[model samples]
Target: MSEAHEARISRNEEDIQDIWKVVEDIKKVLAARPPLWCTFLLMALSSGLTGFIVRAFS
Candidate 1:
């Protein structure tokens, strides 16, 4: 194989490894966070606000 072609392939492999390391680090950080029940609270608040706006405009 030509030297330039081999160099290009080596650089590509290094880039893929760097990308995987970044993904693994993000996964670890997300796994360490505690789960919360905030979605339901937000949904209820949004629904109430929509109803209020509709009633005020009617």
Candidate 2:
């Protein structure tokens, strides 16, 4: 193949490798205790507000 075609292929490969590295890092991060804590906090707050609204309506 031509030089330009080879360079383009190399660049595409680099981009794909970089993306995979980023995705792996994100998986590691999310495997830690972050999403669980955030999800629990959101659910607790929503349920608290729902209870208050139910009491107010009743």
Candidate 3:
């Protein structure tokens, strides 16, 4: 193959590898985060508890 064609193929391979690395990093971040339901549950529980305390003080 011509040198130019070979160079293009090499660049394409490097770009593809970079894309895959980004996808993997994103997956790791998502896995580490808490699920939406868990976060919502915590917020609801805290709000309810605070409301209860305020009501008692009144």
Judged by lDDT, which candidate is best?
A: 2
The digit string of per-residue lDDT tens for model 2 on 1-58 reads: 9999999999999999999999999778777878786798799999999999999999
Per-residue lDDT of model 3, residues 1-32, tens digit only:
99999999999999999999999997787678
Name the runs in model 1 displaced over 4 angstroms.
34-58
Better of 1 and 2 by lDDT: 2
Query: Which has the higher lDDT value, candidate number 1 or candidate number 3?
Result: 3
Weakest 10 consecutive residues, lDDT, candidate 2? 29-38
- Model 3 deviation from the true structure expressed as Cα RMSD, one decimal place: 11.1
Query: Could you report the Cα RMSD, in angstroms, for every candidate shown?
Result: 7.6, 7.4, 11.1
TM-score for candidate 3, residues paired by index: 0.59
Candidate 3 — worst ten consecutive residues by lDDT sum?
29-38
After superposition, which runs of candidate 2 have C-alpha atoms over 4 Å from their true positions?
37-58
Task: Supply the TM-score for candidate 1.
Answer: 0.58
By lDDT, the candidates rank as 2, 3, 1
**27-57, model 1: which lDDT tens digit per residue?**
7766675343355557889999999999999
What do the candidate models score in CA lDDT, each in turn? Answer: 0.85, 0.93, 0.90
TM-score of each: 0.58, 0.59, 0.59
Better of 1 and 3 by TM-score: 3
